[model samples]
Target: MSHRPIALEPAAVDVEVRGGIRPADVRHAKETVAALTRLAHEPVLRATVKLVASPHPGERRTAQAVLDVRGRLIHAQATAESTRKAVHLLNDRLRARLLKTTRDWENLRGRELRDGEPGRRHPAPPEEPLPHRPRREDPVIVRRKTYALERAIPDEAVFDMEQSDYDFHLFTEAATGQDSVVYRAGPRSRGDGYRLAQLDPRPGLLGPVRAALTVSPVPAPVLTEQEAVERLEFTGRPFVFYADAATGRGCVLYHRYDGHYGLITPTPA
Candidate 1:
């Protein structure tokens, strides 16, 4: 079967290489990403590629890309010993995601393509493990990000989470106007593997959600930052999501790849 190639405007794709990458390598990364974007079936509104040099010897370079395809965002990341290799791996990961998303969208609309069609399913590549982190006596918060929480339905939040390769996503529930979080409930083998937690959830407030989600009956815990940190240490979970007692907003405190702590708080809307 022959399919028309989609051409993306050169200006729509942005590439940024950091950590002293050479000009030739930067151009190579950009061209590679551009070629990947051109294969999209839908209009590629915008594409961004970021390459960072890792200090660790195990994975010397990391490549990540985010694509805005007809208003939907898709993200992929890869790491390799060399810059060119990293970009090539990123391309493979992004291609698989694009194909899977297209197949899922078509299925949702009851327009599934034939078995050997262009949008045939492709399994995503396994993610690279985090670089080794030196043991630390006490890991303090090394990074903090504050931004306005995205207001979206649970389905939208889940989609954003999966696209961004995030384990959990914090957002304001559009239906109830409450701060909420949706996270992976368990391994992929488990049912849908999605769960929802809302702040002061009320009975019969949620509408029909496309993803199978287990809503927590208990309201989200309200805690100060110090208290949250203490709970994080006690529970040994990857992240702790809670409502800030001072500002009454959703916040996430999680373990960073470098064996440090990172905090994400919602700014005032």
Candidate 2:
């Protein structure tokens, strides 16, 4: 129904198979990798898969996958009885990696506004978009959501948010790291203006960097955990709800690209 594979860009898979001197072993290694590569094109979320074999490991082979998205890297390692099993293990590992990648990319949206476009000079590693299928709970809000901001000078911040596909773009003061927000800032009717959110308590360990879906077209606001709650109560403008304290009142409000408002709140009753 919804985009199943969250990854649009495929991660490069590298494998090293080592075992007994058998032709099947070699064939299986190649086949498994070929399968994943082919899946990448279908809907399994694949990019480039490279397989290598050597007699170094002898009896056992290891799977090492360096899953990277927009420079965000996650390493997965698994040992298996055979190269086929190892590839399967790597497949599972990549699924988990994408989950983490999805959440992190969402949060990065807030910081990209002023930080300049992601992958400008060092652009994201060459990868393909993986087919994304949303879970029942992970509903599909929208597809290909797009918005244009006032010429956000030094476009790096905006670029990063685009790369991550965040609901709201958070901007950092050119020299000061002070945070600002840019989303549909005017009345829901006028549908214009991306206001600067008011962050509170600022951010620290166990911080409030999280946001709610109701905050913007795409929910995560760009601000430190401490300042995440600070918002200007402008009449008729989209604003974020927040609570800042150990008393358990804080949230990073935002909207999914689908137009669903969400609240990334703290753990309370």
Candidate 3:
């Protein structure tokens, strides 16, 4: 399930610039948010970001940046003689939130699932916290293998997705002559359900070597039918995976960790 790119309300974010803040200061704050949106899209992690800029009511000396996700918002405020300085600090707070979110997603993706039984998975405790370190490239050891994708009926895509431990599966659509993708979504128990997103990366970043947008999509709240919802259910130890399919693009699924899940989707480079 993935949401195609749309103009989101960003109901989660609210930004207020104070009297001391200049127009440029607000611009910087938006720039910072945009930068983090790009950085957080590593193949291992993804997010849905919406930004809002509004007038800072009263006391121009203070500026505030508030971030919201899943109905929870974290706000940071600073009072400075100049809005630039205040925005500087405000941007820092937002980055901190993004950093924490990225770390959480990393922990989820890097889960050490011990194979206690044939198909049973047991979670491992997270590693000791690492000291603050700057991100610099330490040349990665690249590995490569190849496989041919077989055409499958849409229902067949569901079977393949469920059977695999990996988050995504590559396949061909029986109806379309395009190389398509199928991804899994859900940890939704009860009324929660699963979604399978399809994507075509024929217009990829590279001709011979193209990589699909490697993240699950985020879902917008919508009414689900009783019978249709019945078919979208999943049972897992503990993970949250809600997904949506945009009108065209691909799908996004909420991941289920022990207790946390975030948006995943494919984005243009």
Candidate 4:
């Protein structure tokens, strides 16, 4: 059966500038993002650019953009001392990501023809940590997000994470029907900078994963939310993944760039 084509949204892009940004800089941001959208292989459904100038010291001017290309979302953000510099940096990052997404699509199609099976996209380039203020002495959970996790294979999960400009992604593993997370393993890691952690790992249960993945031999530690916070502080890792003691589900306690904590919990299926 043939499927209907998806309708594309209007070409108008949204630009929001806050904190006394000059009109010239604002126009530059809009034009740059509009130019980037023209490079997308898919329909540009929705696009938004936000520029913020903070009065606080060390909180540099920031530019962030989110583009909805058909059903996929591409995100990029950059900060600099000047608005123009931030916008330029943002453009460079967004352009790179857009190119990567296009490459991923072409690669997948080629592999399908050769292997006669679904193909995996290349891993995203390593991400640099976001600049932030000094760590607060008493950091509290400022953002709490609870959502139904996506069910996907490790390869697909990695693709989504990269497209969304996330350092890590949490999802339910389709192969073994277990909660899992795939994250950048850092430059010091052994393999292709990707690691997988599952709630209850089974050695041979997972099917073939195309992307180079290092599965954590140790199962997710069981801990309460408070305990997870302590672990995050003690370990000094970017994020801590653990099995929630009360829910028996995987949760992540992460350090936000704003010197606060963020909690991610999976909603019941």
Candidate 5:
């Protein structure tokens, strides 16, 4: 769709071709820059469009766009059979991201405005529950799925996790050959960090996946529990993982909601 005339000059949009992209697709994206800027509800500072081709047949073209609104970078991505379709999908995703960012900004601003008013005080902290209530949804194995796990070290895994834009990532620890996951602890905040966990299968269970998986490969460096804990604190991530020096088994160190560190180890049945 056409948008109101705005500054969508030649330098406003940058289309980077990795493999190759159709000329028509690039033209369409440039033409739609104004519409994207309007959706952002602010003057677009800069825009980057990336096109990459995949080996797969049905879904070959992947499009990614990064919009710089002021100092914030909003990202969108889409994959389709055709480059044109992927670009369109990318535009739609970018619009959605802009809408969400705008809403969140407005909400935060409203909270600040209210909190700054006279005669208003900061809300009290939540009361501690002696025993947590059970969740409404009962435990059920609704589906079973598996992915080939890639091998990586804790640091490398954390880097990959950050780049993937996923809450949690599963990989095989390069040092111990054990399965591990790097995950985020809480809401996005400045200095908010990630946590790492490792799985040591109980006796007779499968261990050390040797298969290549769909994940970034990273180097695994052995870490002591104390080192992991220190890393956790330094990163401000919720948890950390390493081979427990005492147990010789995989272990997880995490931050408990009550402001304490909790450790988990698998015990034999």
Candidate 6:
């Protein structure tokens, strides 16, 4: 493959070559790095490209690019049949991620500015703690993972949740500091979107706790069952808990593990 002339501004970008990358491939990558100069200005748009040796002879190279676009990290990687093709794929993926993140960030900023305008006061509804009675039953503890609860807007959380490709994400509401979980409800074709369920830990339970538990009292977002189902599909999770806006009751939407969804709503006592 012919080596393209390097167009990347050396002072603004740093290139790291690793594994068994050939000199010619490294030269191609330097030219490809120039592509990112259009994404951001000099000095502010810094990027690191790591070229790794590909295991298969057909796919001769793997490229990983981590671009620091004004402090926010954007990562993309590609493995292709050729070094140049791999670099091209990496750049394409990186551009898509950067554009999506930029659009989401701008939309969030715009919403914040609008919410700050005067004469718009939407107070949260008053919430009373739900009754909780301790259950005495030995349960199996299979797995446990400690995670730091980050405070972010729902849009940002959704972005992270989608990127993580997890069933659910637990985060704190940036506006209220309320601990919340965003979970997938069902398939996206069914109009299911991500649903946020704020944790409202109920008191008045008396028992010897069998396991360590941390609960935070907070209010959940009120959405109808249909709305909850729509949000559930976005997270790609099996279940979600949401406050039913119609009945003013808490409900759970879960997958039956047989290609179906089960909606559990509070019954009148």
- Candidates sorted on lDDT, descending: 4, 1, 5, 6, 2, 3
Better of 1 and 3 by lDDT: 1
Residue ranges of candidate 2 with Cα displaced over 4 Å: 1-59, 67-74, 99-104, 108-269
Model 1 pairs in collision:
none
Count of backbone clashes, every candidate in sequence: 0, 58, 25, 0, 2, 9
lDDT of 3 at 233: 29
TM-score each candidate: 0.71, 0.27, 0.26, 0.78, 0.42, 0.42
lDDT of 6 at 112: 33
Which candidate's TM-score is highest? Answer: 4
- Give the Å shift of residue 32 in candidate 3: 2.4
**Superposition-based RMSD of candidate 3 using all C-alpha atoms, in angstroms:** 18.8
1-269 in candidate 2: lDDT tens per residue? 54443333222333343334355544554444444333221243333332333333343444445434434544444445565665566566544444434544455445532224322212222222211211124332232222222223223443344333333454432422333353434332342423334333222211332211122223234444334422422221233644434433334454321223334443433
After best superposition, candidate 2 residue 211: deviation in angstroms?
Answer: 18
Whole-model alpha-carbon lDDT for candidate 5: 0.53
- Give lDDT tens digits, candidate 1, residues 163-238: 6766789899988898888888875334355888888885377777656577888887999988988898888777
Tens digits of per-residue lDDT for model 5, 1-269:
63342345644689887566678777877766556776655556888887775433443576777777776667766666677877777666566566656555534322322334321222212212111112223322222233456666554554444333334566766776676776654443423455444555321233332211232244223567667657767776555556556555545556532234656554521
Q: Which residues of candidate 3, in runs, are more than 4 Å off?
A: 1-15, 18-20, 41-60, 69-74, 105-269
Candidate 6 residue-wise lDDT, 1-269, digit = tens: 63332234744566687566787777767667657645553233566777876333433456777766666666766666666777887677666665555545545433432334321122212211111111213212222233455767655565565443334566665765555666545443343555555645332331222111233345665787667756766665556667667755455665432234566554432
- Residue 70, candidate 2: Cα error in Å is 6.3
How many Å off is the CA of 236 in candidate 4? 1.1
lDDT of 1 at 135: 40
Clashing pairs in 5: 153-219, 153-220
Angstrom error of the Cα, residue 177, model 2: value is: 17
Best by lDDT: 4
